[model samples]
Target: MRRFYAILVAAGLVYMLFMFLGTIVPYGKADVADRVSAHFLAKDVNSISPTKWVEGDKQVPHSERVYGRKGFEDGSANVVTSIVVNYRSFDTLGEVTVLFASAVGVGLILGGTRRMKYGRKPNFILRVSTGILLPLIILFGIYIFVHGHLTPGGGFPGGTIIAAAVLLLYLSNEEFSLNMIVSKSLEGSMGSLYVIFGLIGLAAGGAFLFNFLPNGVVGSLFSAGVVPLVYMTIGLKVGSELSGVVAEIHEEREG
Candidate 1:
């Protein structure tokens, strides 16, 4: 009965979504860009005083007027970053929830207390190579998430990269293990921090995950206000979650 109700609720939501979409007038190719997207590209969704968008105007292109525009409302240089982490950040939160759910499901199914194992013992070369490359990989992951607002990479990809480093360690050294205390602690804390930041936004600006912090000059490391901090928490959470998954899989494989 609960499953049936869930299906019913999901079906109703889909119907409502389609109905909402049907009501939206298609802003044609030549029409003044959708105000939401226009503002996103302009990096001024948080603008105290926003100018309304007009026809034949900015759509996807970053105008020189907005390029490196100081005192930006969003302060994120990457347009997609502005959209993903700034404009529709709630969607990004939903994405984090989805990944968390997957990790939980995997843990429930593959949970184990045994040691992680591989098919055969790796040689010294593999172990030494992993040792040499591990720091570099983790460093690159940090770079990716740290520069997320300025570049193409973000928390998800960056965290995955960090988890890849953990995977490398497991493959090269069968006895090597991640400290569960630290891993679980980091994962739980980071996830909680992500939501706490959202709650702070709610308290400060009447919106969850609001960019309440002041926008610094565009194209700078500290420019995107609370965005970089948010990404750092996400990267840590995702890294720990995925590392947990890798541990589970490896432990179950040879257990």
Candidate 2:
């Protein structure tokens, strides 16, 4: 009976949609006059035409302007990085704050008085392999964040990758533990560095996160003014925060 009612409701909605469209469109075969009327109704009834859509002469898009000027102005090969770190940096900071709050919330909720040792120790082979792989994974994460201004990936994904490497260690070694104090400290420090950079921009250039520094040669490692610096700070902050989140969950599970 419920399904029948739902079907009826869906059918009624479809019927209403078709009826509304029917009112806007002529019902039957049309003469030249009807065809003209229909054309005007569909094309001009909206009170604007393609020619009049914009207020001025067909303008070049802002993105196009950015692309042409990015080399000198932003010094980043990757356009997305320039936008995120230089154009919309405040939003990125807000995102970091939200992630930090979430991590803290998880810790408060899951942390308890008792110590936890849940998973059994893995074999020697697994342990040794993980130990070997861990450094490489961390290095890759660092590379990803460092080259964010020149490449496809950025701080957020690179940081998550680093956290995953840490998680792999936790899974392989039962005794492996994340020091909450150290992780939190690193997270806090990175966050502070990000803010300090913004403050420096404000003091030096009169705007928060202003590109006060020189934009080096495009495609160079040290280019992109504050973009790489901001991304690196974000990478450290995200990596530590996510690692702490996983640690909290692991502790709760083991306890």
Candidate 3:
């Protein structure tokens, strides 16, 4: 009976996937083949832009303005970064808030000290290697979040990386402890700063999360105004929250 239900679910999922693909991909393969060939043979990749069949209310197809005017609006070369941090910043804030709240809830639920005894101690090599790698890993995380506007990775992934580093430390040294107050303070400060930035945009006679900061030179380290700052803030908040969660869980498990 279970197997039959599982098969039914799998078939439904496969049918849904096929329907999705059918909607996206037209029945005709000749056009697709021609386009693929043209794309491969095109002299300038920019000239071979993808066609958007969808039209707006004005019967005009929206074009890729990000690539065309990279520096004018937002100085982020990376469209994903610009969209995530600048265009949909308020949404990102909500996402971070949700993550923070979840972490806090879990930490609260699992908050306790119950030390589980393990006979074996961490080896000298593991301890020394973790100590050596910790700072470097943290630096890498900072770099990822800081350069999110120009690169692929952003605050969330970078923060997870930093949290992973903390987890490594916790695993290596049982005596290692996270300062809950400090972590909470940092998290609160970052989240507040995000809101303050939004308010600043509102005060400036623009909508919330308006790009009020001067769009500096494109592709530079300090180009994307408020983007890097926001990402860093998110990184710090996420890192702190996740590290605290880890500490709470670890303590509960081994208190």
Candidate 4:
């Protein structure tokens, strides 16, 4: 029976290899730009035109109406930012919830409840080094999250900082144990709140995560309506999930 199984597996592998080769054998390159141009100039080009719905000689506000004013009204200078945080904030909420669930799953699989055998007793030098670096790391994380709109950093970076601080605590103090319940609670609550906030937008207005607040000055710190809010939720959720993972890993190592 074992020999028969081995033969079957070998045959399956050969069959898969043949199928894979067949896909690559007929590899052909097509002119992408030509295809795009053909589509654009097709007989059904009217479907792609933006001015179809506008009636009469009314000047279509393509720049001002669709993006500029609408985007600024929502408080984000970046149209993409406005769309994600305001128009599609529910997706972000769901993403964070998925992360939270993944963290919980990891903790459960790794036996998070198991206590460590050896307490984390860092030497004086290590303790002092961590103490000094902790604040700096935290500050950097905050800087990333706060300036997410203007620059590259964002909630993910900030949350990573918070998790790093917790890690430092775990490393410096042997008796230090993360409050899994608290962390999990916070994660779940924030995730729920994020979704609820988007739902509220739908209830009050017609859109989910619609920017109801005033669209402050474009370049100002408070410009983006729901960008800050959504980013904050992301940071909180990521921090909690990362910390939980760290705690689980620590417990596993100790066990």
Count clashes in each candidate, considering only residues at least 3 apart in sequence or on different chains.
Answer: 0, 0, 6, 3
Q: For each candidate, C-alpha RMSD in Å?
A: 8.0, 17.2, 13.1, 14.0
Report every candidate's CA lDDT. Answer: 0.77, 0.75, 0.72, 0.64
Clashing pairs in 2: none
- For residues 1-255, write the lDDT of model 2, one tens digit per residue: 978855754664465456446545475655555342322222221222333221135543334333344432446777677767877788998999999999889988986543366556577897889979999999999999999999988999999999999888888878778888899989998987887787677657655667777786667899888888999999999999999888877775432
How much lDDT does candidate 2 score?
A: 0.75
In model 3, which runs have C-alpha deviations exceeding 4 angstroms? 1-73, 113-119, 253-255
lDDT value, candidate 4, whole model: 0.64
**lDDT by residue for model 1 (60-94), tens:** 32343354343334478776777788778889989
Q: What digit string (tens of lDDT, one per residue) describes model 4 on residues 1-255?
A: 978855754664465456446544243565554442332222121123454222146544333333344332335544445545655565766667677778878877885455575543578786788878988887787776766655565677789888999888878777778898899888776665666555555445545565655666665688676677767777777888899888887786433
Evaluate model 1: give its lDDT: 0.77
Q: For model 3, how does the per-residue alpha-carbon lDDT over 10-50 read when each residue is reduced to its tens digit?
A: 66446545644655645664455335233222212132455
Q: Among all windows of ten consecutive residues in candidate 3, which has the lowest summed lDDT? A: 36-45
**Higher-scoring candidate on TM-score, 1 or 2:** 1
Off-target runs (Cα >4 Å) in candidate 1 are 1-34, 41-73, 253-255
Which is superior by lDDT, 1 or 2?
1
